[model samples]
Target: MNKWKIILDYFLKFLTALILIFLTLIIIFKFTIFNKNYIKNNLKENNYYEKVYDSIKENMENYIISSGFSENILDNIYTNKDVEIAINNYIDIIFSNKKDKIDLSKIENKINSNIDEYIKDQEIKILDKDSITSLVDDLLKIYTNEIELYNMFDNYINLFSKLQTILNIALICLLIITIILIIVLIKLKIQNLGIIPFTSSLMLLYIRFLIYNNIDYKNILIITDNFSNCLVQIVTKIVDLILICGIILGVMGLIAIILDSRKKNKKKE
Candidate 1:
């Protein structure tokens, strides 16, 4: 065997060990060592979640006005054409921006504002102040409904985000193991033309990634945002999964090297 080959074999083993260490450390940080809240919180800080809060508030205000006119007004708040657009916008603001913590108080205030305008159309009848006061009291029910809706959305985002994180972690581990195994098998069977097809496929896969994506192999980023963005999010986690596997394969390449060395020695003996 070439002296250089021996050196390379040792290097490969060390490299695999290093990768495993990193994986272990990060896993540790994720579950035990690091601040568990930081991931979602960091997501929130990425952009001003306050903006989403404001938008929800605005939607609630619109809901109030439409509701006060008649219970039929709920149609405008949820089923009306504009309501769909507003809901979509709000989703983008929270999910697109990765912020699930929504503020319903802002929304309640918005509903009340819209209701205030509709109330203006009612002429003040001083003949019965009690009746006027009663109307105002009844209108507050709309605020309650708007707040409930906002809370529902908040719960949805929270659950969705947690699922996203768990999926990412699982994919990462799979990719790393896949890559290491592939690389090790590749080195061991270097002379087997039969395995060339697999290598070709791998090369093509790598080329596809390099050409289309520009993400770091290590220290990947998982960004979340409020629900206004149209871009799909699974891309980030999937790409990370692929890269993790690739790295593991690269690190585990030494198994093939060792096997090949033993074969050459046997032939000589």
Candidate 2:
């Protein structure tokens, strides 16, 4: 009977550790990758949108400078930074989201307005307004039609929504299992509470390792520096959470072990 009881206690401790690890993973996913709206909001809050616009403007300027668009016209456009302002205004409109459907005409009008002011203020000479208009239209069309970029976001949102039901069910089951395991361990007079925090710290260490190993910083930078910055910021938030949880768990586990040791010492005395 004593041997069987010892085996049962060890089994319960093993199960408790697994449950703790699983619960930590679910919570991390719930707060990080699965939270679509939060990521979007964080991007906007961090001025990532503006940085993207700046990158686009720099790329466009480089193109206009190299495309043989006539020296004087290029001089006026680049020297006055007319395109930069126009692109910035257009990006602002895109981020505003004041309307349900984003109309190209709205962006066109905003850019046109900025361009008119730019021309008047800089006193620039350019014969073909239509040519400039056509160029801007083409760029806008290309930018908006980049479904791959937009689809990245759409895919994340869709994935989170799809997983919501499954996550809900799993979360409930895991939570119940955790509670039952805790109660059973206590009843068996085993120190399973320390396993909770110890498992949490181990899980956080694994998560940190994955984050460091999986993210290819060079590839992310090649895509866009602004995007890379945003990715780092988000990942940093996750890392911070991991560190906080690890510290708390490590402290709790240490305290539990110390107290358990003291109880044993008292029994010996």
Candidate 3:
């Protein structure tokens, strides 16, 4: 009977450790992937808007030159603030699962106004109205494509939202089960509850190591260098966050073991 009880205790600890591992992954996904603000904050940190503006300017320059306009026509066509607003709106559309298109009225007006001023200043009358419209449309496309790289995921936003809800429910259920297991272990005088967290922490660290080593995130090339820079920064930060969580759990596990040891020593005395 004593042997069977020991076996049961070990089984319970093993089950608890398994749950802890899943719980750790769920927490990481909740904070990093499912969290919209994580992306927003990373983009802001990496100056993503400024990079986007530079790309837009470069792309539009080709149109200006082909249309026989001075490069000055591109001046003040748009600002970094405008790009920031447009990108944020694009993100909101994806996260909110809205079908609304990004409002380019402001940008369109600015480009048109600039072009009219340039044509008047140069007194050039040969440019076709359709050509001007085509130029404006093409420039706006650049902004849309750059900001909407992840628009493909828009279809899954609803599925992701449902998955997030399920994860929250699962996490709560796991926490309740863990608490019950802790109580049972304590009553059995099993002081190895720390093993669950310790094992989980190690698993997290191993997963982080695998991702860091396997993925060449530093050299990731996406739609453009600017976009890639922001993507790399976000990925690197997520990896660092995983490492931080692993260290925290490891420390907590050590503290738990130490406290349990002290309790056993007091009982012995």
What's the true lDDT of residue 180 in model 2?
83
- Per-candidate clashes come to 37, 0, 0
Best by lDDT: 3
- Residue 84 of model 3: what lDDT? 87
TM-score of every candidate relative to the true structure: 0.32, 0.65, 0.85
2 versus 3: better TM-score goes to: 3
Error of 2 at 158 (Å): 3.1
Cα shift from native, residue 126, model 3 (Å): 4.4
TM-score: model 2 vs. ground truth: 0.65
Model 3 Cα lDDT, one tens digit per residue, 1-269: 48988898789878887777777777777787667898888888887888888877887787667767778767876788878888888778766667788887877888789888988888889547898788778877876776676465567767866897898899899889888887887788775677777777887899899999999998999767877887787788778887887888889988888887888899999
The list of candidate 2 runs beyond 4 A from truth reads: 59-103, 110-137, 142-150, 154-157, 210-219
lDDT of each: 0.45, 0.61, 0.80
- Tell me the lDDT of candidate 1: 0.45
lDDT of 2 by residue, 208-256 (tens): 7787788654345534556667677776777777777777777887788
